[model samples]
Target: MVKRLTKHGNSLALVIDRGVLDLLEIDADTPLSMTTDGKCLIVTPVRDPERQKQFRAALEEGHRKYGKMLKRLAD
Candidate 1:
């Protein structure tokens, strides 16, 4: 879908469609991090640092607890 940037005082803004918003599970107030990879523009939701840390810790704990079962299943 094509989008046009609208003037927002000094900056420009793109109006995100509702489908995109729902798919991304983001709202107008959600913070997003943007970057470019020399060719394409990349936009992603910014995970809260504290929440991310908690998630990583939980994932590590789960891996440790389930590693044996998972390894057995894989064999």
Candidate 2:
């Protein structure tokens, strides 16, 4: 599907269709990252809530196991 870029403030914005949004599992408030890979543009959701929670838990576990070493290094 093709979407036209519409004027938003001083910039043009491409409005994504509902079907594409649903397929990508993204909502209005979803955080996104945009980058260019050579001639192509890549857009991705930043993180899923469950994945982020798991990541935080792992980070905390690492801190618990290596707290002293980390503190010593910082000093």
Candidate 3:
């Protein structure tokens, strides 16, 4: 769906829909990070660094344990 930016003071803001906010579990208090690939904007919740480290560790362990079996299954 296309959305038009709303005038906020001298700048513009994209008002997020309540349903979309609820689906993403984003509230006013939740921190968000915005980035762009020069053409499109991407908005996402800021994830915890420690949680990310834990996830990477778990993924490494899973790959170490199942890499061979998974590769065989894929082929």
Best by TM-score: 3
lDDT of each: 0.94, 0.92, 0.95
lDDT at residue 48 of model 1 (Cα atoms): 90
Q: Give per-residue lDDT, candidate 3, residue 25.
A: 90
Candidate 3 per-residue C-alpha lDDT over 1-75 given as tens digits, one digit per residue, 9 for 90 to 100: 789999999999999999999999999998999999999999999878999999999999999999999999999
Query: How many clashes show up per model?
Result: 0, 0, 0
Which order, best to worst by TM-score?
3, 1, 2
Tens digits of per-residue lDDT, candidate 1, 1-75, equal: 989999999999888899999999999899999999999779999979999999999999999999899999999
Per-residue lDDT of model 2, residues 2-75, tens digit only: 56889999999889988899999999999999999799778899987899999999999999999999999999
Cα lDDT for residue 13, candidate 1: 88
Q: In candidate 1, which residue pairs get closer than 3 Å at backbone N, Cα or C atoms, i.e. clash?
A: none
Q: After superposition, how far is residue 19 of candidate 3 from its true place, in Å?
A: 0.9
For model 2, what is the C-alpha lDDT against the true structure? Answer: 0.92
Instruction: State the lDDT at 53 in candidate 1.
Output: 98
Model 3 quality (TM-score): 0.84
Between prediction 1 and prediction 2, which has the larger TM-score?
1
